[model samples]
Target: MGTRGLVAAMALMLCFGVDRVVSDASDHRYKAGDPVPLYANKVGPFHNPSETYRYYDLPFCSPEHVKEKSEALGEVLNGDRLVDAPYKLDFRVDIDSKLVCKKKLTKEDVSQFRTAVTKDYYFQMYYDDLPIWGFIGKVDREGKTDPSEFKYFLFKHINFDVLYNNDRVIEINAYTDPNALVDITEDQDIEVEFFYSVKWKETTTPFEKRMEKYSQTSSLPHHLEIHWFSIINSCVTVLLLTGFLATILMRVLKNDFVKYTHDEESAEDQEETGWKYIHGDVFRFPTNKSLFAACIGSGTQLFALTVFIFILALVGVFYPYNRGALFTALVVIYALTSGIAGYVATNFYCQLEGTNWVRNLLLTGCLFCGPLFLNFCFLNTVAIVYSSTAALPFGTILVILLIWTLVTSPLLVLGGIAGKNSNVEFQAPCRTTKYPREIPPLPWYRGTIPQMAMAGFLPFSAIYIELYYIFASVWGHKIYTIYSILFIVFIILLIVTAFITIALTYFQLAAEDHQWWWRALLCGGSTGLFIYGYCWYYYYARSDMSGFMQTSFFFGYMACICYGFFLMLGTVGFRAALFFVRHIYRSIKCE
Candidate 1:
C-alpha cells in the first residue's frame, strides 16, 4: 500500500477505537438496587477524640480520601475539606446492608442498637473539599412488612447545622430504603437515594461563625497576613536581583563589549581573556547534547503547562469547590502537552548535530515520566499494602497507562517527526575551534555545587512561604483556595530563576568555563533541592505526620515534584543564559 493509504487506514482505526471506548463508557446506565459507592473528600481532625471515644470505634474515612470506582448503583459525591470540623466520618454505602436493628428485639438489643446507631451512623456532606458530619436519628422499625411495600426509614431527622452565618447550607442525606428492615419475608431489591438539600437560616452561634472563618482561611498557613508577607518578600527579592542584573548587564557587560569590539586596540592591548576569549567555544556543542536537549524540551513543556494551569486557576476555573478538578486538569494538560516535549527535544537534538532522532524522541518522552512513573508505582504499592485510600486502584493505573500509550505517546511521535523534518541548525556567533579550551580550577564557593546552591536558593526563597501552604494542601489536610497569590509567586519564581541563572552563567563564563549549558540548567533547577530540603524540614520538624507509609508517599512524590521543578527552572535558566551568551558573543569582534 502507498503511504497515503496506510495513513488513511491508521486514521480510520484510531477513530473507530475512540468511538468504541466512548460507546462502552456511555453504555453503563443508573439502575435501582445496584450498590452505589460512597466517597468523602477531605478528612481532618475535629476536636481530638478522648481515649474512650476513640475506643468506641467511631467510623472514620481514610485520611487520603482516595475515591474508587465500582460497578454499583449510586452517584459519587465530592466536596471540599471542612478544616474546622471536629470529627471525621466515613461515608457508608447501602450495599453493606449491616443490620443495626433486629426482629423481636429485647431491651438489651434495643440499647446496643441505639449505641451503635449513634456512634457509627455518620454521613459525610461536602461543599468541595469541606466535609460536614451528620448522624442518623430516630430509626423506625416496621414489623412484618411486606416485600412489595416501601419500608425504608426516612433520613430527614439528621441533626446538624447546615448553615453558618447567612450562607445557604448544603447537606447530603443518604438512606437505605425498602430492604433496610431485616424482617422482610421475601427477597427484595434495595435502593438508596443520596439526596442533597440547601438550607438558609438567620441564626447562628459564635462557634459557627468561627468555623466559617476557619473554613475560608483554613488552607493558608498564616492566612491573609502570610499572603501579604509573601508578596512583599518576593517583591523585595526580585527587586534586589533585578538591581544586580541591571548593574552587571548595563555596566560590567557593556564595558566588556566595548573593550572586545574596539578596532583601534592593537593585538598587544587586546587580552585574550574573559568571555570574549572563548567566543568560538562558548557556543560549542556540549557533551551529552541529546540529554541536554531532552531536558530543555521537557522543561519547556512543563513551563507551558504550569503557566496554563496557573492561568486557569487564577480565573477560578479550578476552584477548591471542584474536587479533583485540579488533578484532572494537570493530567489532561500534561497529556496534551506531550507534543511540545517531542517537538522541542527532537528539534534541539537536531540542532546539536545529533543523528539518533529515535533515541532523542524516546528520551524526551521518558526523561521526566520514567522517574515519575516509578515513584508513583512505589507510592501506590505502599498505599495498597497499607489499605490506604491514596493508592490508585489497578483499574485506574491501567487507565493512566492507556492514556499515555494511546494519546500522549502518539502525539509525541508525531511532534518528533514534524520537528525532525523541519530541523534548523544552531546559529553560533563564531565557529568552534579544532581543540577545546582547558578550564581552570575554581574555589569551592565558585564551584558548580555552590553556584547551584546559590542560584537555587534565591528562587526557592521567593516561594518558600507559599510552598508551606502548598505542602499543607497536598500532604496536610488543608484546602488551597488562593490561586491568585500562587500565580504571583509562580511569576516571581520564574523571574528569580531567569535573573539568577543569567548572572551565574556570566560569572562562570568570566571564570573561563565553557560548559555553561548544563550548568545554567542545573543552577536554576537547584531550587528543587531547596524545596526537597523544606519538605524534609516540614516533615520532621513541623508536620505531625508519622509512620512509614506516609513518609514514603511524601518523599516519593516529593522527589518527582523536585525533579519537575529542576527541569522547569533549568530550562528557564538555560534559555536566559543562551540569550545572554548569544548577545555577548554577537557584540564582540570575532575572527
Candidate 2:
C-alpha cells in the first residue's frame, strides 16, 4: 500500500476510537422504544435501593369537568357498555426491580396518556408496563422542583436531556403535577416519555464533528460468554494445581503407601486361606462403591435440572431475559431436585452388593431431604423479612415437605427395594487387589478432605470469570447477556469433572494407591470448596453486596448445598470407578 493510504488508515482508526467513546455516551437509539436499563439487584434486608419517578398531568379539575368527561364517555359508549360508573382517570405503578439484564418485563411499556380535563401536551404521564422499574435520572430546570428532592408527581412528562461529561452521560427527566384534577377522580392519568439528547463541548482548537462507528456485543441476565481466551485466563491456575497435586498423589500412592513385605508366617497363612490370600485379604478393599453412586446420582440430578431450565427458557416459560422468572425457576428446580436425588441414590445403593436395607433407606432420605429443608428454612426467613410475595409461605413449605416425605421419598425406597430384588448381575472383569493392604497416610494425597477439596477446584476455575460476571449482574447491578455462553460453561464443568476423575484415578492406580476409589472421588469434587471461597470473597470483600447475605438466604444456602452435593458426587464417582477396576483385576487373576 502507498504511504499516504497507510497514514490515512491509521488516522481513521484513531478518530474512530475517540468517536466510539463519544457515541456510547450520546446514543439514544433503543432497539425497541427508549434504550432503558431494565434490571436491578435483588432488594435486600435493609433497603430496596430501587427508586421510581412519576410525572402527573397539570390543571386542577373541578367536579364539573369529571362529570362532563363521564357523560361524554358514556354518550360515546351509549348504554351498551362494560359496567362503567364514571369517567375516572386511574394511574397505577407496580415495580419489580430485581431483574437480570437479559430479562424482559412481562407488561408492555406504558403509552402516552392524555387526560380529558387537561388537554395540554405536558400533562401526559409515562409509566412502565412491566412490573420491573428502574429510575435513570430526573431533570427539572424549573426552580420549584429541586434535583435533590425529585418531585415524583411532577417528573414524568418530558424527554430526557442527555449531557455528556468526560466519558459518562447524564440523562435529565422532567415533568409537573397540577392541582386542577383533584375533583376528577380518586386518581389522575399522566403521560411520560423517555428521550435522549446529546451535548458536546468545543474548546479553542478547531474540532470537526467526528463521525465513526463501532460494534460491541450486548449481554443478558445469568448468561456467560466463555471463549478460548476466557478458558486461558481462568483455568490456567487451576490446571496447574491439578497437575502438580496429581503428581504428589501418584508418588504417595506408589512409593510410600502400597509397598508392603509379608513375612514367611504371613505368606503361609495366606496360602492356607487360598489364592485370594496371596496378595491381601478380601475385606481389605474399602467400601468405595458408595462414592460412584453419589457422583452418578448428583451428576444426573444436576444434568436434568439444567436441561429443564434452559428448555423452559427456549419455550418462553419464564422468558429468557427476565430476572423474576430466573429466581422463580431456581426455587422451583431446587424443590424438584429432592425427588431426583432420592430416586437416584436409592436405586444405586440397592444395586450395590450390600445387605443393610434400613441403612440404605435412611441414607437416601438424608441425602435428598436434608438440603431441601435447609433451603426451605432460609427461603421462609427471607420471605418474611422482605415481605416478598415471591417467597413460599410456611403452609406451602409444609405441604412441599409432606409431598417429598410421602410421595418422592417413599418412591425412592420402593425403587430401591425393586432394584435390590432384581436379578441383575455385575461381575468384575478382574480383582487386582488380593490383600486389603494397609495404605499409609499421605497428608497431601490421602483421606477425604484433601482429595475432595482438590477435585472441587477444577470446574470452578474453568468458569471463575463467568461466575464473577453472573454475580455482578445479580448483586452488583450490571447487565448480563449471552445465555449460550452459560450453556457451554455448564458443559465444560461436566467434562472437567469426568476428565479429572479419570486422569486422577489412573494416576493413583499407577502409584499403586490401592485406595484409588475414594481419592479419585475427592479429586473430582473438591473444587467446589474453591467456588464457595470465591462466593464468600465476592459477597463480603470484592463487591458491594450488602444485606443480601441475610435476605438472599434461600439462594445462598442453595448455592452452598449445590456446591457440596457436586463435590460429594465427584468424589464418590472416582471411588466407584476405582473399586470396579480393582474388582475386575482380581476376578481376572482368579480366572
Candidate 3:
C-alpha cells in the first residue's frame, strides 16, 4: 500500500467509534458530586424480651460509622483520644405510686409512656439512624406478670432528618443488622421502609478541573500515534528480513529459471520422469500444513470475536463501572465464542491436512470440553473460597454445558461439512527444481526465527515500565491519572504483533521454509507471556495483594488472560504475514 492509502485506511479505522460508555446517553453522567444515594428503614414499638429498650445509631459511635459519617457530612474528625457516652433513648413512663408488684402486664392502657425499654432486642432494628423497637406495656413494678403476658403498645420511633436532604436514595430493602434476620415473629407485625433524595458537595480537585477544562478529548490522535510508531517499527523489521530472504529466494529461483530455459532435450527428459508432470503436482510448497490451519483458524475466531465485541460496545451493551453486568456479559460471550474457536480450528485443520471426519469431531469435542472443565474447576474453587452460592449455580452450569454441547457442537459439525464440500487447494507463484540450488544456511544465532522472536523484547521493554505503573494503579492501590495510556498500550500491541509477524514471515519464506509460519506467529506473540511473567515477578517483588485475595486465583486468572493474549497475538501476526506472502506471490505471478 502507498503512503496515501495507508493514511486513508488509518483514517477509516479511526472513524470507527466503538466506545461503550459514550454510546449511551445515560453513561455521560459521571460528574463527581453526581447525586448517588443509599437508604434503609426500620419500624417498631419499644420493648423486647431480653432488654428494656432499643437504641439505634449506636454505630455512629463506632470507627467505621465515624468514617462513613465524615465522608457523608464532608468533615474530618481530628481527635486523637476521645470519649463520648452513647445516648440512651427511650419512651419514659412513670406509673402512680399504687402500682407495686402484683399485677400482670395486660393488653389495655394508654399510660404516660406506651413503649417500655427492653434489652432483648435493643440492637435488633435500625433504619439509617432510626432504631424502631418492639413495644409492650408492663404494669407490674416487681416483675410478677405471667412470663409471656404483655400488652401491645406504641412507642416513639427514631428518625433521621439530616443526610436525607442531600442524597438521592437508590435502593432500600432490609435493615442492616450485625446478626442475620432469620425469621420474624408471628404474633406481632413488623414492617420496614425507606425514602430517598438527591445530594451534592463541592469537593473537586485541581487536577479534575484541568481535565474538565483543557482540551477536546478524542481517541483518534492517540490511536494514530501508537499505530504509526508500531507500523514504522514493524516495517523496518520487515524490510530487513525481507531483504535477507529475497536474496535466498532469488538464488533458488535463478536456478529453476535457468534450468527451464535450457534446451528442449533436457526439458523433455526432465518432464518424462518429473513428478510435476506425471502426477499433475504443479503446486508444491514447503508449508507446514498444521501450522497454516492453526493460523487461519485462530484468525477467523479472532475476527469474529473482535467484530462482535466492537459492535456490542458500539451499541452500548458494555457501559463502564457496571462491574456485575460487564463481567456477566464477558463470561457469556466468552462461552459463546467457543463455537467459533472450535469450528474454525477443526474445519481449517481438516481442510489443510485432509484429516478424517471422525478425528475432526474428536478434536472439536476435546478442545471445547477441556476449556469448559478448567473454567468450571476455577469457578468451583471461587465458590468455595467466597462462600457464594450465586457463583453460576449448578442448574445454570448444566444449561451452559448443554448449550455448548448442542449449539457449538452443531456449528463445528456444520463447519466440517462446509470444509468437506469446499475445495482444498494450495498455490505458489513458481515451482523450482526437485533439488534446488544450495546456499549456505546461516548458523542458529543468525537465524530469522531468533531475530523475529527477539524483536518482542525491545517493544516489551518500552512498555514494561508503564505496565508496572498501570498494575500499581490497578492492584497496588495507587492513584492512576492517565487513561490515555490505554490507547497507547493498545496501539503498541497492534504494532508489535504486526512487526513480529511480517518480519518472521519474510525471513521464513526467504529461507524457503513456509512451514515455520505458525512458529513465527507463536514466537512473535509469545512476548506477552514474558510480559505477564515479568509483571508477576514485579508484583510479587513489590506489593502486598495477598491479604484480601487468594494468590492462587489471582495467578490462575492472570495465566488465563495472558494465554488468551498470546493466542490473539499469534492469530494476528499469522494472518498479516499470510496476507503479505499471498500478495507478494500473486504480484510475482502476474508479472
Ranking by TM-score: 1, 2, 3
lDDT of each candidate versus the true structure: 0.60, 0.40, 0.40
The all-Cα superposition gives candidate 2 an RMSD in Å to the true structure of: 16.6
TM-score of each: 0.71, 0.54, 0.51
How far residue 524's Cα lies from its native spot in candidate 3, in Å, is 3.2
> RMSD, model 1, all Cα superposed?
12.9
Q: How accurate is candidate 1 locally (lDDT)?
A: 0.60
**Deviation (Å) of 530 in candidate 3:** 2.2
Report the C-alpha lDDT of model 2 over 1-591, residue by residue, as the tens digit. Answer: 001111111111101000011112134223312333211112111121111111111121112332111111111111110111111111111122211112111112111211221211221111111112223222323565554442222222122222222322222222222321112211334333322222233223211211100001233222223444575565566567657866775574344222222323244333322222323333233474554454455555555555776666455343222223443344345445545554565556556665565565566555534554565466545544544323443554465456555655565566556656654644444443544555444556645575566556677777787777655544433444445666776666666676567655554544445555456656666665666667677766665434452325423543645454454446445545556455434432332
Error of 1 at 76 (Å): 10
Point to the candidate with the largest lDDT.
Answer: 1
Candidate 3 accuracy as TM-score: 0.51
Tens digit of per-residue lDDT, candidate 3, span 199-252: 222332332122221122222468446635654565456456545755765575
Off by over 4 Å in 1: 1-130, 133-158, 163-215, 218-222, 268-271
Residue 25, candidate 3: how far off, in angstroms? 20
